[model samples]
Target chain A: MRLEPIANPGLARSAGLPAAAIALTVVVASLLALLAGADPLATLGLILKGAAGSKFALLETLNRATPLIFTGLAVAVAFRAKLWNIGAEAQLYAGALLTVLVGTQLGLPGPVALPLMALAAILAGALTLLGPVLLKTRLGVDEVVTTLLLNFIMLLFISMLLEGPLKDPLGMGWPKSEALPRDARLPRIVDGLRLHWGFGLALICALGTWVIQTRTTLGYEIRATGLNLQGARFAGIPVNAVMVKTALISGGLAALAGFSEVAGLKGNLTLDISPGFGYTGIIVAMLAMLNPLGVVVSAIFVAGIFVGADSMSRAAEVPTYIADILLATALLFMVLAIMLTRFRVVRG
Target chain B: MDLIDILLSASFWAAVIRIASPLIFATMGELICERAGVLNLGIEGIMVAGAFAGWVAVYAGLPLWWGVAVAMLVGMAFGLVHGVLTVPFGLSQHVVGLGITMLATAAAYYAYRIALPEVTTPPRIEPFQPLDMGWLTDIPVVGQALFGQTALTYLALLVALATGLVLYRTPLGLALRAAGENPSAVEAQGLSVTGIRIGAVVVGSGLMAVGGAFLTMSAFSSFFFEMVNGRGWICIALVVFGAWAPGKAVLGALLFAGFDALQIRLQQTGLGAVVPYQVFLMVPYILSILALVLMSRRAEVPAALMTPYNRGER
Candidate 1:
């Protein structure tokens, strides 16, 4: 069988394929649930109810999705330029570390400290990614491996600092940073709601990313560079410069996830601030087809599965890892579905 | 002990070989995949699956060798998923590989939870025992280090040798190399490029699974989450460090394992009190990045490494 590219796919074919992919994922999930000796339909129903059945659950999902949105945007932006920045996990840690340092040491007023904390976080994340991007552009190294290796390195660096200089004195033996003061903490989105302003910031970032991708010259250059490097170079786009710029933006965006998790949610930095949000961001970006606007929906969707699955695992006696398996299957099937939208398979 | 004493000790050298064993199997696995023009980023996840599958198989009363075979079969199954998507569907190898990794890892974890729902501590099994060469074992540091390891370690060395021999000395190897280097040429020769590439990935993935099995069945007696921890990624770097040659790749693994063993020993020395242990743990990853940068300019990557080939496409 050979796949032939379709000149133009109709809207129904494009949309229908993704819908079919989701259905396939549901089928896979059902089979897994059956194998685990649970009522498949009830398990799925419980997941759906647990995700958005109550205001608290919905709020929980929004809180979980805040970091994912940032990381998803980061991945989407970087992947658009073909930079393949897989070190968002490292960059997130850098941001969190810087946020904690600024929050604990600066002793500034709330209005002044919060923005400063964000700025520091962005700078740290950007700097973290800059090393790998520079290596890729200058040394012809693969950013995928370099960035990935940095994740382990950054984790160890964080562990060292936490155990040594950054160790919290007031709290007995825990390897955690000092709590961010009330002033440094992020305000809630609403007075009575459980959600924080981080969710709002994530939305704003998603919108800003959309604008940058659609209405800006840098965005055009990024798409051009990703599509064809030599062609973009011949067309007078500064390919290397664009890649570096994309890295800065992507890294900075991913770092915001750390900043938000530290300041908005946890009010302190811990080793486990992210439950693989950086990695999950890749799934979000791909599920959204790398579209900036679509990241919000995908992030929320991914977060809902995790949140729902966590609760479902408690009530249903199933492992919470079902969330991961579901999302992974969704990502694979979705990519294949997206491919099929533009191509038709035919026996040669 | 001081640095020199640690270096001279047979235990340290044995530790190096033990650490290098998994890397050897995985590196050779990755080498074959890349040589056939598929990146197989699913290696990390596949290794995780292999580790879990092998341990669980043993825990379920299968023989140790049978556990190893089970791991290989599971690894190949994942590989087939990777191969089908990247080779035939022509999806982005990067996305598909990561997806596979996530899927395999999640499935393994889920299976573990289902299999041992109430167990807090990961259950341990009897692991591979070291071979005794009675007189050889008495011969000093070199003898014990070389001959005292479990059978899996020896198998790792033998696999590396076989990989070198098969890749450089066989027609099948030539076809696999051509699939990566010049697919059109292989197609012109009437050989199935798709078949050769997929076959390489399947076989290579089986070896990678064995690497993971070594962790459970030899290096450690129990399976744990995060056991495979970036070893698969490091193997990818080792491939570049070795310039895609099997012999050099095995050497790269040994060199890395040497650094690893030295760091573990250093953590117990006087210097361990001054420098944090995390810093020592950081050495191998930092070395991998450095190795990539150092070899980047000189290393000749397979020409069609990440590109997907469509029939009749220029």
Candidate 2:
């Protein structure tokens, strides 16, 4: 059997498949809602209304999606370079720790402190990810395994800090860091809402990623390397260096997610902040077909589903995990839809 | 307590065996799958599914052994899902694997919550108890630790050794290995590489389910949301650390289990206060990374790993 993509699978037709997949996912999710004893149409209406029905919902949705954009971009960068950096979650934690540790200790003005926190977070994410990168590049260690395991190690490392030295002495015994001072917390973009300046940073990061991926030498090397590692090596492209740099950038991007959450929203570190954004980012990257710009749109879509589902659960008897089912179903359909676009399957 | 006091105690060795049991099964399962070139990153999710399925079955008044069967069957079904997606479609292995993990885990958690609405005070059943070793349990320091273990623990040891033998000594194993190493060669020899690879994946998934069953049926004997945690990931690492050899994989699992058991003891002994217990928990994961670095130089990856076997395509 062989697959030959029909010559120039028309742009519209190519685009049509993903749209069809979205429909398929919605139908499946509706059936699931029906099983949970809810009217599918009503459930869908509830989700839509809860997601963006009002002014407050819009801000909340964007705020929720802010971290996802960073993590999704993190996953996109590494995946596009054919580097599997599954440690993004841990790298996010590393950034969170640095945001608190550096902010409290340095005591710089807001402008200097914010940039310093961002830089420290980026460096922290990159350096923390260096272990897996070296093992992967130098020794051929499976990054999937190493990076994944490093998440566990990172979780333990951060938990140690949060519970031991960094524990807030006055937060009634909860294991979280002291709140960031006014100088350190990210400035708010709106009054009476949690929206913060990190939203702007996230937008800029997405734009920067788009420009880099589509219009630069490094981007060319990365895309080429992802397309064909052997060919890239043969073409005198530094595949190893590209992989390392992508890994660093990927880690930095993920770290910024932590920075956004802590500095922009929480103003303190806690274990409950991220709900698997690092892992979900993979789905976002795949949904966008690894396009940097598409990541922003997909990230927001995922966030909307989750946040809406939370409100839906509060309003109805349905559980919130139904969103997980919807998301996973959508991903499977997306992959199948993509494969269909790329290949004309023949009987084996 | 001192290092000797920790290592020499019967409780220490028992904890090691108890902890190593689930990993031994998972690592051996991974060894076979990787050897056959399937690279089922879905193993983690499948194990979680198995744990939930087994627990639900036993809770519903089925025989304990029946629950084990339920686990294996559920795992095989997922193995089929993974095989169809990766083997035929040639989708990204990591993407499919990660997606399966998320879906299966979420489904399991949902089922647990929905099935048992009394989440505040959950029901419990009597889990399998350790076997009686009689005189064997009476032996000085090693007696209780080595002999007084659950039946699953001993089965895990036997499975590890059996896997090593089957991998090295059997004809089917040869076909599986050949399929992974050079599928084109195997296909030319009038053999179905795809069939062998799919068979490998299904069988590996079944064993992994049993490993999951061990967690619910023997280790903790209760289903928790995050029970499997990262053990599946650890098993993946153990396979690499042991260079894809089942016997060595068992040893690697034991090493990790020993570290895990030791940390618990050190923590309880108040030494954990000196260094936060969370830091001590990092020891096993960190040590495994070091082991991977040391072992990767001699690692023997299957040539066709993560590659779909497209029939008649160069």
Candidate 3:
């Protein structure tokens, strides 16, 4: 079998293939449930019900998706420029560390403190990624391995800080940071709602990212650079400058995930603030095909699976790791499906 | 003890060799894949799966060697999936690799939970014992460091030597290297590039699994979550550090493991009290980055690495 390029794929093929990918993921998930001796249909139902069956569940998912949206957007932006920033986890931690530092140390008013915390977080994250990006641009190193290695390095740095200078004085022997001041905490979206303003910020950022990608000069440059670096260079585009700019934006966006998690949901920063949100962002970005608005939708979908699976595990014998397996399957299948949309498989 | 005294101790050298064993296996594995023009980022998860597969197989009464075989087969299965997507499908290697890692890791964890539901602590098995070299073991620090190790450690060193010999001496090695450097040339010779690439990935990934098995079967007696840690990623760095050569990669692995051994020992010294334990833990990762930066200017990466080759495209 060989693949032949399609001249133009219709809307049905484009839409149907991704839908079928999701369907395939569901089928795989069902097989896993069967392996565990649980009823597949009931297990899936439990997941969906636990994810959005009630107001609390929906709010929980929204809160979880909040960080995902930030990280997903981060990955989407970096990948669009072909920068290959796998250190979103490190960037997120950078943001979280700054948030904790400023939120706890500074005694400014809410209006002054909140924005300052975010700015510091963004700067920290952007700088965290800038190191690897510079290494790539100057030394001709591959960003993928450098970025990945930085994640481990960043976590160790965080651990050191937590155990040393940043340790909470009030907490008994636990390695955690001090809680953010009440004024620094993000207010709920609605007075009675459990959701924080981070979700609202995520939506705004997604819309803003979409606008930037579709209606800006920088976006076009990024796309061109990604498509053909030598061609873009021949066309007079500053390729290295574009990469640096993309890194700053991507790092800043990922850092926001850490900020929101600390200042919005969790009051204090800990080593486990992110349960692989940075890594999961790659899945979200790939599933969205690097589309910013699609990242929002995909982040919510991914978060729902995690939240749902967590709740479902309590009720059924199936482990929550099923969520990871399902998403991974979806990501692989979706990429293949997307490819099939533009290429037709033919028997030679 | 002081630094000189610590370096002179037989125990320190033994730890260095022991730590280097798994890394040598995984580095050689990664070296093969990169040499064949495929970057198998699934190394970490593949290692995890191998650790679990090998340990569980032994726990279930399989012979230790059979357990290693089971781990290799499991690694190859994941490798096949990765090879299919990245090769024939022409998908992004980065995306497919990370996807494979996530899938493999989750599947391993899920299977473990299902297999042992009630155990809080991971169960242990009788791991490989050190071979007795009689008087060879009596020869100062060098003796224990080189000869007083499990069969797997010797196998790791042998694998590294074999990799170097095969890559430099064999016809198959020439074709494999050509696949990475110039696949069109390989195709011109009436060889199927796809088959060669897929085979390299399969075999390379099998070696990576054995590296992981070395953890459970030799280094430790039990399998646990996150046992592979970031060792797989470190091996990728080692490949670059070694400039994609098997002998140099083995040296890189030894250098890295030496740093690791020193850090562990340093933690017990007076310096350990002055510095945070996390600082010592950070040394290997930092060294990896430094190694990359230092080698970046000199290293000759496979010309066609990460590039998907489509017949008749040009």
Candidate 4:
């Protein structure tokens, strides 16, 4: 009998691959820019200027990054616990719809109304998560399928609201909800700044997520179960409970993002309230290598791409879809590069 | 309400077939892919791609069938890319799947703007003609309901039965099932996991493209941006509702289609004018969630689904 022994030198390989992935994404994206008939160097400059060159630009970037922060954290949290919840977009809509119902229909005072709306958002989001969670836990349904399916339902619900019940009667037939009252809106963090208190909330949430992920007992159990559910079960962890708990927390965080978008940026509910922020969060979380602090940087980077892409569209006459292609291409490049961390590549 | 009278009408049946056509096509494709363990998330993108390509081909003066052929070819090409990326390149399934979606969406949007710049009414071909069975039309309810659907509707039902038989009673089906359930185990037994997956991807995406073509050739004679409108995702759910089988998925599609038809009917009725339109419009999605919640007990996910396979590794 011939035995082939496994030679596992792991730490060195893992340590080197993440940086390699980032570099690969940049290089591949530069090549793609050439194909799109734009100079990569010039495009990068425009992106920088658009994202951070001026106070206004930087403010916009941060404003855009705010919801991404919460959603990136949401995806990262559920992913860390080994659940694939692809329904964040739907959860965001659920949150937004609930916030509208609470904030607009009830007609309460500002301070009290805002908190009530936030609570409603969180509750709606968490409730939406319960179906997938319970189906996975009790009925052996795959959460991936259940959650992905729910996304359509949520979007359709939004369409229903916007096109019918929630349409602003004052807007002359626009498919949008009534705008929140002046008191219901969040104050800008500074004069002439697009930044709102949502940015602060995002920052605080990031810090809170970092601490919860690293310092708490729940984190330990969640992390252990993520590594191997059966092993965690053997180690006396209640795996199913952890999965459900983490999923609800994730959904709640994502919903909070919806609140931020509605209350912080857009006062009125619109069909396109999310410019795919929830979906973008998936790539951001994965690119961050699932680190809480890393998610902040990755979110900012993604926000820059979105912000800069518009400038490039204006300046170079390049379509914004080019930027979309670049962003998606870079994500694929990153995923491919990351695969090298676990598996060695050989030409043989 | 006169909802029952509206439901009993011939137009209501036409609406049901129209709504169900794309879903039947998509769910069938998803059924094949899931059976083989690939879980083609690219169906959303592929459907969008097909919608664009089919419309473009039609606008370019090609026959509708030719447009469909080109769409299927394009879908197959996309499947090839998806298969190679995950199976050979060993990328994350979800990541590659998402990439395909984004790529297809961007491509469709770009192409739509380029091709249909001035056409406000949208570029349309003559839609597929409804097939009226001569004798079957004599039966009041069943005839109007089942016998007067377009060719694609009947074709969708045929695809369902054919897929069902193939999936359950063929050697290829057995091999694909083995690949999905336990690739490494299958590979140990001298099967080609990559080959099986690639084959599944091609066939599945091709089916999804037909679903897309159904959108143009039967439901509407034109294509628009994001026109699949989350139906691909709905098909993904339908796969679950069908227990990853073809026959049940068609049933699920028809069930949802019935609700959609009723919703449209309600939208046209006097009662609909009195009530909020949102409640009527939300019927399909709300029904989808209800279906999910109700059928949560019957989920039987494939064991090896979504897991990237390695050649002979533990």
lDDT of each prediction vs. the true structure? 0.94, 0.85, 0.93, 0.80
Q: List the residue pairs that clash in candidate 2.
A: none
DockQ of candidate 4 (2 decimals): 0.40
For model 1 chain A, the run of ten residues with the poorest summed lDDT: A103-112
Model 2 spans > 4 angstroms off: A11-13
Q: For model 2, what is the error of residue B219's alpha carbon versus the real structure, in angstroms, after optimal superposition? A: 0.7
lDDT of 4 by residue, B103-203 (tens): 77776775675555456778678877877789997687667668887877888788888888887898878888888888877777787888888888888
Give me the runs in candidate 4 sitting further than 4 Å from their true place. A1-45, A97-117, A156-169, A173-178, A181-184, A346-348, B1-3, B88-91, B117-121, B131-151
Q: How would you encode candidate 1's per-residue C-alpha lDDT over B255-294 as one tens digit per residue? A: 9999999999999989999999999999999999999999
> lDDT, candidate 3, residue A188?
97
Report the lDDT tens digits of candidate 2 across residue range A229-333.
999999999999998889888999999999999999999999977888888888888888888889989989999999888888778766788888788878888
Residue B89 CA error for candidate 4 (Å)? Answer: 5.0
The numbered model that scores best in DockQ is: 1
- Ranking the candidates on DockQ from highest down gives 1, 3, 2, 4
The segments of candidate 3 whose C-alpha lies over 4 angstroms from its true place after superposition are: none
- The candidates, ranked best first by TM-score, are 1, 3, 2, 4
lDDT top scorer = 1
Interface RMSD of each: 0.6, 1.5, 1.0, 4.8
TM-score for each prediction?
Answer: 0.99, 0.96, 0.99, 0.89
